[model samples]
Target: MSDVTIQGNILTPAGWLSGAISFGERIAGIQGAAADPQLNGDDYIIPGFIDLHVHGGAGKDVMEGGDAVHAIARIHARHGTTSMLATTMTAPPEDIDLALTAIGKAVRQRGKNEARVLGAHLEGPYINSGKLGAQPNFARAATLAEVQRLETMAPLRVITVAPEIAGHLGLVRELADEGMRVQIGHTLGSYEDGVAALEHGAAGFTHLFNAMSGLHHREPGMVGAALAHAEYAELIPDLLHVHPGAIKTALRAIPRLYCVTDSTAATGMPDGEYMLGRHTVHKCMGGVRLPDGTLAGSTLTLDQALRNLVGLGLDLADASARVSTHAADYLGLQERGRLVAGAYADLVVLDRDLKLKAVYIEGERCDLNDA
Candidate 1:
């Protein structure tokens, strides 16, 4: 196929440029001049969003297995996500296995107009049951053998573990040594426990300040540990999972903080009930929640995540990094997040209002209307 070229106010790694980017499956060339005030326009071209924690979208839950992951990938691609992890919920081993098997297939057989499935993000089964958050009551302890078996089912790129659990600290070290991105979440672990996990190779915190312990002047729980020591972590920027004030505080503390959707099956669907692993959650009041009114996940898409960050007083470039570049960096993905030459031709086009106008994955334009 011939090269496809797009011209706009391009967001290059250096900064914004008034130029044209040419690409086919990969970026071939970027030609442009410095930003010209006289030619300022409404159009902006930025790298596609990368979501590290994604549960479901478009009426499909990841735990449903089969074609569910495919539907979720296509729906998220419509909202400017070029890639994401197939995040699973806490359930029995058989359920988790089914989800991962489906995710592995999707990763290998990425379909047309679908966001690339990077790998499986095992978010449950091995966690502290006391702080289950929206997770089911199936929390258990981690074992290297079990994790190794799961890895064989799919590429376990990222896993959430509660270091306070028995033998979990050592498991964190082992997984990190093996190159998996271990994250702290769904735990009642103390501040010291959080610190020890970080020292033992826990690379990040999952949905910071939500499922984990909170920060107090005396206790300085997991949230405090993250604020004090974490170099990378993810926050749900839907403006609901975390308050704006708290999000601001985290922004000041963590330099490599990124954004995630934590979206549920109700995403892109009308207000209703949907399955989140073994539990059925309600989608209402702009949030997904359990019957007891606990926040389950979220109804956010990445484009809206970008807008929410900008609304929270972040500049457009900084918001873009949170939604795209930072997550890519966290995953050690060199080719998917930025619009520089030699990267994959994955990107999004937006108007001055930050609304997605078009999306491209591996140089193929998506049909936004189909979303």
Candidate 2:
């Protein structure tokens, strides 16, 4: 028997479709023509947004503990992010372990609230110091032993490493062989280095255009390489990470640009002083900036990214592919991200205006009408 039947516009797993999804606790089933649960005739159902590059939100850091992960995750869940990876910045090896350990625990343990923790994304410590956006330089470019230690800690679904960093690219292959997705980021590598690393098994790009090389005609740096490998690129389209026009150009070149908020502790907090580990980041204008005006993480939400990218005139199916569908396939998550029968009924119900109506973490619903 179905526990809850949500009608309205349901974003199904197959794609954004109009149907009723009935579930008991977690996703039990997708209610269609043959199910007891009925749906509203015309509500927009979208798969809950999946953020692969989020650090913290709702004034809590994921590194704190399961409580903190739950707190931050619940807040993003309100925004329709049914699943997320708790990302970590470049910190000491011990600190990274703490965060990853916490996330690993969260993934194994479920609560009555919060989005599902699919896995972890180590965005730093292994990254190049040169491309460290706001990560402390003290703990940069550790040896392969250190990288392997972090990789094997839990299930490292995604690791951000610099290809040009001392033998890091080789480790990228090992991680890939272990069925982990490796991304290239935080580096000063040339185009050739990025291309070679891709040949070594790097499947995606992390927060493209932030703390990485800019595209130059002659150099055609990492940014250029990502653009060249459109089918294999992930980008943060918050306008702060990459310019709007640049986002447009890259979208034209790259077919599979995914959107990530890369939000930090200051994300849901006010525009004042906020903590990002040992450093303090301030929200200025619409973006976060370090003490010296370097771009720290952002406070953007995925809903905002979808509206912005859609405003850029991309097709709806293609844009949907970039966020919900493509992100799932990228992480090799077979069950969720697409709305279909016998799949996890984790999704977001939005209005025609693209604002969130109600968000479902698994089958539980949270009203976002006030948000």
Q: Estimate each model's TM-score.
A: 0.98, 0.90
The lDDT values for all models are: 0.93, 0.75
Per-residue accuracy of model 1 over 232-261 as CA lDDT, tens digit each: 999998888899999999999999999999
Count of backbone clashes, every candidate in sequence? 0, 16
Q: Which regions of candidate 2 are displaced past 4 Å?
A: 8-19, 25-41, 142-144, 367-371
lDDT score for candidate 1 against the true structure: 0.93
Please report the candidate that would top TM-score against the real structure: 1
Once model 1 is optimally superposed onto the true structure by TM-score, how far is the C-alpha of residue 139 displaced, in angstroms? 0.6
lDDT of 2: 0.75
After superposing candidate 1 on the true structure, give the runs of residues whose Cα lies further than 4 Å from its correct spot.
Answer: 36-39
Say what the RMSD of model 1 is: 1.1
| lDDT (10s digit) by residue, model 2, range 1-371 | 35777765444534444456666545655555422213333656666788888888877776665567777677777777778888877777677788888887778875655778877888877777777788877446646566667755556788888899887778888878878788988889988888988999999888888778879999999998888874656677777778888888877886667888888877667778776756788887778889999888888888787788888887555666677777888887777777665667777766667777777776777655322
lDDT of 1 at 224: 95
